[model samples]
Target: MLIGYARVSTLEQREDLQVDALKAAGCDRWYVDHASGAKASRPELDRMFEVLRPGDVVVVWKLDRLGRSVQHLVDVMVRLQGMGVGFRSLTEQMDTTTPGGVLVFNVFAAMAQFERDLIRERTNAGLKAARARGRVGGRRRKLGSSDEAMIRQLYDSGSVTVQEIAGRFGVSRGTIYRTIARTSKG
Candidate 1:
């Protein structure tokens, strides 16, 4: 059985093109997901996996329709293989059932991993450089020095409770405690 999977980034986008292609490729059943590929939870995709049986070939109009990233695609392929199922991408002309197709897919997966590693290395290097330049990366402080001083004075004077101060400043009690800790540290 050739089971098809079609996807679109949003509900507004049409899956007609992908569905038509899958039909042309002789898919007997279909699973359609109308959500962003970046989303981790895809109900339709999950359902498709549940219905997959041994000797079934999972077909997609394009490789991207099946996975958001190379690692994800490779993982899915490995899972299908483990279950004695096959994978095919119409646009990429890939069929895991064949030796040459398997070789090409492995090469592509390796390249994708390499690319991801390069990106991670570059990002870490860039972040380190920025830190060296005294450019710390994180959210900006919500409370200022004066606010901290006032909080301390109110707490020390015993005129206001922690919850009262937090409510006045529209911040959580944890934020107030953190502010005190930060002020004490400095």
Candidate 2:
């Protein structure tokens, strides 16, 4: 049996294209989910994996729809293979049932991981260069050190609640709470 999986990032997005394509590809049953590719907890995907059996084929519109991380995709594919289930991605034209397809997928996965590593390297280099030039990182603090000290003192005195301190300082309660937490931890 061929089972299809379709996903969109948000509930507002439509799954029409993926659904139509999966149906056209002769999917016997399909599951759809409105979940982000970066998110690990996808109920539909979990259910599909649970129900998959030997001789079953799992299909998706694209490799990205199944997972964002190459390691994650490889792990999922390995699990499916262990269960004697075939996996296919329509857009990438990858099918794990065939030797050639498995090779192609492995190459693609390597490239994806390499690309991410390159991006991280470049980002770190840029940050290091910026730091050497005396360029400070991150958002400029909305509240200065003096303001933060005052907020902390108010909280320590137990005279003002976090919300009250935040209101007085014109900051969010989270900001006030985080400031207090940071000081306490340090």
Query: Can you give the TM-score per candidate against the true fold?
Result: 0.79, 0.65
Enumerate residue pairs that collide in model 2: none
Residue-level lDDT tens digits of model 1 in 46-93: 999999999999999999988888888888888898899999999989
C-alpha lDDT score of every prediction, in listed order: 0.91, 0.89
What TM-score would you give candidate 1 relative to the actual structure? Answer: 0.79
Models, CA RMSD each: 2.9, 4.8
- Tell me the lDDT of candidate 2: 0.89
Q: Using TM-score, give the best candidate's number.
A: 1
Point out where model 1 deviates above 4 Å: 9-17, 156-159, 184-186
Give the per-residue lDDT digits (tens) of candidate 2, residues 79-186: 888899999999988988899888986786788788889999999999999999999999988988888888889999998788899899899999998888877745
Q: Tell me how far the alpha carbon of residue 26 in candidate 1 is from the true structure, in angstroms, after superposition.
A: 3.7
TM-score of 2: 0.65
